[model samples]
Target: MSKWTEIRDGMVSALDVSDVVESAKDQLITDLTGDGMDALSTVADKFITQVQVQAESEQGWCMVRDKFVLPLMINGILWAVKLVLAKSTPATATQPEAPTGDSQQ
Candidate 1:
């Protein structure tokens, strides 16, 4: 095998993406749904609740403001989803944070 191939395979073997994916999926699924309901279903339920709540809020957003606000709302949801996934997956399964050396007085 080529050196690059060996390095790529070693990297892949070191990280079990399936474990991280499964763990993150499991967490997004709330127990709000009883047995027999799968993770996707629970994720959808939570997603709907978040959007519905924001839509129902008294934002006083007019057509001009909504053009900007709608996208911001979607961005907010994306941030929330990523945060949950990061929390669900083990620290070792994800990339390590870069070091910020040196202290400021």
Candidate 2:
């Protein structure tokens, strides 16, 4: 199971409603949901950071292996996807298009 799902299940299992009022239960649910969202946000942040690092490394590798068609294709696809994503969503910053040389084609 996913980390968020595990956290949610744990929270649900720990809730003691025998003596709690209905309003209190509602508050508890809201608090638990917030906690879950916080956890998810943390996980997402970490993933984005790792992806950024890996992408940088992949670019270096592509430079070294420029003659390989596979690397060029992979980089091209990544750039296209990034462009599509940036257009569909909000732009975090201006992202320049990936450089392509004659060897890439």
Most accurate candidate by TM-score: 1
Q: Encode model 1's per-residue lDDT on 1-105: one tens digit a residue.
A: 999999999999989676676555555443312232345446655765565566655465554344455556755765676566556555554668777876566
Listed in order, each prediction's TM-score against the native is 0.32, 0.30
Q: Report the alpha-carbon TM-score of model 1 versus the true structure.
A: 0.32
How accurate locally, in lDDT, is each candidate? 0.58, 0.56
Q: List all candidate RMSDs to the true structure.
A: 16.0, 19.5
lDDT of 2 at 88: 44
Q: Which residue pairs does candidate 2 place in steric collision? A: none
Off by over 4 Å in 2: 1-29, 59-105
Residue 91, candidate 2: Cα error in Å is 33
Candidate 1 residue runs with Cα over 4 Å from true position: 1-62, 95-105
- Residue 27's lDDT within candidate 1 is 51
Candidate 2, run of 10 with poorest lDDT: 85-94
lDDT of 2 by residue, 71-92 (tens): 4555565556545544543232
